[model samples]
Target: MSHGYPKEGFNLVGSWDDWKSFVPLSRSGQSGSFVARVPIRRPPGLEEFQILQGQDWAARYYPTARGEGVEGPGNAHGRNFRVTPLPSDCMQLEILWDVLGRKVTWKFLNAAEQEIQAGEKKVAAKKGAKARSAPRNQASNRGPFFLVGSWDNWKGFAEFLPFGDSFRTKVKVGLDMKRVEFQVVVARDWNRRFHPTSSGDGLAGPDVGHGLNWRAEVGGKKWLEVTWSPDRAPYVEWTFPDPADAHEAAAEDFAAMLRDLAKEGSGAWFRGMAGIFEALPKCQRSSPYGAKAENEATARCLLATFLRDLETMADPRGPAPGGQRGALKELEEQCEQLLKDTVGEIDYATAGGDFMQEALPVDPATGPVQLKLWHRLVYLPLVMYVRNTVHLYEMLERLKAQSSGAGRGRLRALLDAKGTARESPYSWLVFSIVGALQILYHARAAAEKRGGCDAFPLELLASSPPQTVWIQDGVEWSPSHGSGAGAFQRKQVVNCEPMKPLGTLRKGDGLMYRGIWLPADADEDTIRYQYSFQSFSRSIEGVMRVLRFYSGVASTKAGEAARAGHILMYIGVKFQGWRLAMASWQ
Candidate 1:
């Protein structure tokens, strides 16, 4: 038999597990004709069957009275086609189906091709079928579909209103429910359920089982829109554009924002850091390195506590804390030993000038003086702190830059009010120290090239052996070795370009030397100790400004002298009267 639409296929569904155990009819070489042969059996009598278009029950051929050639209010009650009982002797039967104009007809024949019975039925015209049959841009006649899920215990379906080529529904999900899962069903039938694939496109399959349910957060006021092409084979999309109950003001929102930023080349490290920040209690959200004064004060107290903890770990006189020692505890012990032994009895005032002028001594016999264990202990935590802090700062700056109007106002307020440094002291210190280390390492490397010591500081000092780290769509480099040496090594960790500072000979655009990421924009002082010294100077100035602000010192020369006095006392440096003249008051 032939159909009006030749490309459309039909399935044979009947009373015996009709939905599950169905047969597909084969199209005849003659245009739209379709044919299928069946072998009759006893026990469960085969009395009724429906010719469904592909897997869609909504587009089935409903059997009608002989001459009623159209589907409407007249033939709305037509059920599945009934079959006449076959003779006891007969076993095989062949069926033929065809549609002509508005009428559909089917007939059964014996093996000899003799017609046993014949029936003629009218095809149901879709609602407003005439308009639908017009030009491509005309209004469509496809009826609405329904949604079914755990909401109604899967017993009944909910209707979706048509809008252009899509269908939409406003579902009332319980406010207390964590999530809602459902699927689109056509014609309230089990055989025509649209289950989503991994890619979110809908496909007709068996019962829409658990885990196969299209899931969405239910505690929010959400609008679900499903788009489909009427003339095409089954392809459907379900999207939720806005969720009214989204927790934008919560920590999870910031975490999600960080995750998104990490999708860009330079942001992968933010993923793990974001988790740590998200887990922090709201009261502890502020970092000492933060921009706002109040948060910074809280951070300072926290830092003091952290330092005290370190001192306890360092003191051989005291027992270490119980439980498995973490990275911080291990580091504290290393720093404690280094402080007590390696640089013992040295005054910062006397040593500061030498450390600043002589770049640590490297013996010609050994490559470079192995960095003290304290450097390793201090390095990792400082790296983590600097990375997390800088990431937070960059995120806020980008948000403030991108937002406008009321959004911009709110972000601007957050930018100004948050305890994040506009020029991060923690980041500056981290950069400066790491830069100084890099310079010392490279100097030793250069000297080794000229028949000097072959030892490298980073290689000797790094906690883990050098390994290449990869960034998605970005350059790669080793963290424990200087740039050119490990550019081709295979082992990789993070997924972002290694930091490459401006005016450097490095091939990449980011740095992760010695397990610490250095900002690409900061100037590195490889020759004249200008950048590191300037960074240290600025940091001291920042501390002085903070002291003056807290002390309520009015802008004056005496107030400046007091702030200078605080710094000179802390660093154990002599206050040269002429140098004090150069200090700027806030």
Candidate 2:
């Protein structure tokens, strides 16, 4: 509506001119109304138009509410006005401005001067009587509106009944449907349908059919309450069935039971995986320690047996009793064949070199090669388990990232560790226990392959024994041993009961222990084993250096050639002649 703009400024912009040209509106004499006459040749069903002031969009007249013949924005905003012209040869449109609202109230008339459609109806009330609203049950003058959508395969329609100046109807809607697209139409005609102005609500853009249908999410509701009126656009609301209806209640109960069962099944699968990881080490230990020679005859077959058992336990059917399952039996057989055909004929160092170089079987070029007992059973199985475990951890990290609300908080609490431990201790324990089994298997296999001479002492492989020390009043008796360890525990404090690693145990000690050590004043050492890969790597490197030098020296002896060979194989490297240098010893 033009507030104070000149009447000559108002012009009609419509689809008849492709909305590119504005047709000037002439001022009606003395009525202060602006009018535009549609020529007899201009045929119309529904015509889109807008009234602009001074031919500028910034001053265009938009309808704040839909009136009788004009369809304004319904459930949408910033939409052009649309109206259906009567079948008459010519029609005239008159507009009155609402200055405060900056909108237009319009009416169209046929040549007979009879009103066709009015934007709003003005009611006259008696002077001494109470004002009354228009009749609610009266149907629209145009035609009955019908509701159509995927609910009925888009074949049929549900007629809307007038209710308090608006049309409404109830239709059955399934909660499981992913999309429920529908529209309001007059007499069930596609040519006279209503659609949402916003395209993002599961609707296509202007290039599609007549327009995009209105979409509803349904969202676990049995019935949808659809409504349409002049003032507001067509929209839907959820309408649940009566709670006392036994059939409806039974359906809801069944759905809830299904949800609970699904949750239980998922939980069981996760717990089963955790149990499998926990049992892997114990299963390896239960196999006779070094009796593979008598049963399998070769280290290769013995290692294959271990791999078969490991994969069998992870099968969905359940943990295998002890040996091979059908899942990976063929792969296990191939590993045995490959090792037996290649091990003694080729350089054994090549097998060890490949295994160490590709700790993971990620390189496609070398992944299928299994030439030694270590490669087939020890390294391959360990790497496979580690890789799969990493995948599971990655999935858990993604779940943690996407999780929100109470569920996210609970998941975070379950996955995260408290205090200094950044991650769950159980996760670390799985890796440590699995690595230990592989180490033991490798040692036993290597020794057997070298005729039982290529064996290293347990003390050489393990960490330094924790030395006993004492503390009083938060002061250590032997700080010189170095308290660089990650943690410690107090066995006894003079007359006090034994305490956990707390306050003084962490502050007073200077030496990091391989395990819990007893106080110097205690009756005996209370060893608590705790080890890591970093410690083992350092220890093994030193032992290899010493064994290499000794092997070189022993090679010169009269009948010690076999002993020297075993020594070289055990350390997995050759002595490049000892050099006298400060860095070499360090």
Ten-residue stretch with the least lDDT total in model 2:
523-532
Candidate 1 regions with alpha-carbon error over 4 angstroms: 1-144, 198-210, 222-586
Encode model 2's per-residue lDDT on 13-116: one tens digit a residue.
66543454455565555345555543221333456667776666666665545542332222233556766543432234444544334445556654343565
Please list the residue runs of candidate 2 whose C-alpha ends up more than 4 Å from where it truly belongs after superposition: 1-142, 201-211, 232-586
**Clash statistics: count for each candidate:** 20, 5
Model 1, poorest ten-residue lDDT window?
526-535
* Model 2, CA-based lDDT: 0.37
Residue 15 lDDT (model 1): 44
